[model samples]
Target: MFKGLGGLGDMTKMLSAAKEMQSKMAQLQEEMDNMTVTGEAGAGMVKATANAKGKVKALDIAPSIFSAQDKEVVEDLILAAISNAQDKAQAKAAEEMQKMAAEMGLPADMKLPF
Candidate 1:
């Protein structure tokens, strides 16, 4: 109740909104850490799992490609899978941010502090 304080009321409102946004962001970060995305390569022989925060959580490799001659190929597959997982994680995070922005009545193109 910043009555008669002119701009003080606006500043108080702004501070309250900023604080609410900060709290929402913290909650979103926690949710992103729990959400996961999976990427696969070599026809599903290699799979990588990562959180929406872009941290790799687990990797799965099929045993059929473990031969000596296929070592390089296996490595390539692993790299590809990891890259794909990271990409998906980024996209997922962006999508979630966009949803949050829309829910908060922000412009769709407004960039959030991620």
Candidate 2:
């Protein structure tokens, strides 16, 4: 019970909270890996899918956009879509982290290395 240990009880509570937070962060990382976002380019002719961890998972291209003469354009669109997906993933990850921080009674803007 640490009744005689002044401030020890408070310290123990803080340590417990810290450990809980660390566990939550680890779980969030796993959830982020499973979360997915999609980005599109070329008027939706190209689409890119990425996980919240910023890993591209798949790409979808409308068949109509594919042409022998416009190969370069298609490539550019694909790149743009992928870049957009990554950006969205990053934003989503930041949003989730902010939410987690808030739930942990920390500043929403606090940056924690994942």
Candidate 3:
């Protein structure tokens, strides 16, 4: 409605769009916290679940993998599962962000702050 304000109109429009995008981003962040991915290692002897935000939620280890002499092997499997879970979480987060950007009419490759 700033018809007579010249450039102010464009600035106002830009600010409004930015505000809307910020709101959408916040909502997406909340969604990511609830979204989860699972990763496994050592032929599924160890598994880790993490949220899209890269926070580990739960871990599962096969009882057969637990042994006194194989302690180090079990530890390695746990670490590998955790790392895989984190990697998947990061990829999922990026995919979600790209989808969001596309929905917002922005370039799919446009990176948004995580």
Candidate 4:
């Protein structure tokens, strides 16, 4: 054991922690990519599904809502559902980040680079 290399021990610990954090963040990113959330509008007649990254994965429209004269209404409902899904995705991402920070012993209020 090199007694003069005392500072190296601390540096090694810091490096290990940094590597661990990086690995956890990457895993979290992958999880978010596969995690899906759904939003609906018009009393669930219209539904939208999006991943935590806010990418729209699917949309569903009730056949009864299809009408030639109500085209604009259908369009609005679709937009509303998409917007709701995006908002929820954003919130869910934030929650996941916070959880990771907490587990890493960082301050809950600390913002993580995602």
Candidate 5:
């Protein structure tokens, strides 16, 4: 419909693409908030759960790993589990973005605004 204008057509197309992308991004954000990843350490003795946005949601520790002398070790394990959970969450988020980009006919490796 934007026939007479030269660059205006391209601009219009860009604007349409931008709006679509914005809508997709909002949906993705909501999905990420609901998506979860779990990370474990010490042979699954400690587990940390995080959302795809890398927010730690909860943690579980096995009773066997609890000992007064090993308090520091337990703390370390908890930290490691949390870090692993965050890493997994980030990877998951990236994978989701890649999937969306692919669906949009964009480069699968394109860095989406997350």
Candidate 6:
């Protein structure tokens, strides 16, 4: 139908692709928010959960690790667990983004606007 308008057909296709990409990105964001990862430290004495966006959601500490004299150790374990969780979240997010890019015929390394 756009034959009379030079390049209009191409422009229309581009626009449609852009819109589809936008929608897919939005859906990916939502999925990332819901996806979670768990990380552990201190030989599983401490555990932390975070979403793909790197937001910590919960933490768990084995009661046995808690001691009046080892308070500093407990604190360190918690920090380590949290750091691990955040790292895993970041990795998962990147993996999902790469997968989405691949599915959309984009370069796997392309940095998408989140």
My TM-score estimates for the predictions, one after another, are 0.93, 0.91, 0.93, 0.90, 0.92, 0.92
**Model 4, span 29-109: residue lDDT tens:** 999999999989999999999999899999999999999999999999999999999999999999999999999998999
Ranking 3 against 5 by TM-score, winner: 3
Tens-place lDDT digits, model 1, residues 19-88: 8889999999999999999999999999999999889999999998899999999999999999999999
Summed over model 5, clashes come to 0
CA-lDDT, candidates in order: 0.93, 0.93, 0.93, 0.94, 0.94, 0.92
Candidate 4: regions farther than 4 A off: 1-5
Q: Better model by lDDT, 2 or 5? A: 5
* lDDT measured at residue 69 in model 6 versus the true structure, 0 to 100: 98
Q: Cα deviation in Å at residue 66, candidate 1?
A: 0.9
Q: Write the per-residue lDDT of candidate 3 for residues 7-40, one digit (tens) a residue.
A: 8878999999999899999999999999999989
Candidate 4, residue 84: CA error in Å?
A: 0.6
Supply the TM-score for candidate 2: 0.91
lDDT of candidate 3 at residue 14, scale 0 to 100:
98
Candidate 5 residues 2-72, lDDT tens each? 56779888899999998999999999999999999999989899999999999999999999988899999
Q: Give the clashing residue pairs of candidate 3, or none.
A: none
Q: Number of backbone collisions per candidate, in order?
A: 0, 0, 0, 0, 0, 0
Q: Candidate 2 or 3, higher TM-score?
A: 3
Superposed Cα deviation of residue 67, candidate 4 (Å) = 0.4
State the lDDT of candidate 6 residue by residue for 1-114, as single tens digits.
Answer: 656899888899999989999999999999999999999999999999999999999999999987799999999999999999999999998898888889989987798864
**Which parts of model 1 are misplaced by more than 4 Å?**
1-4
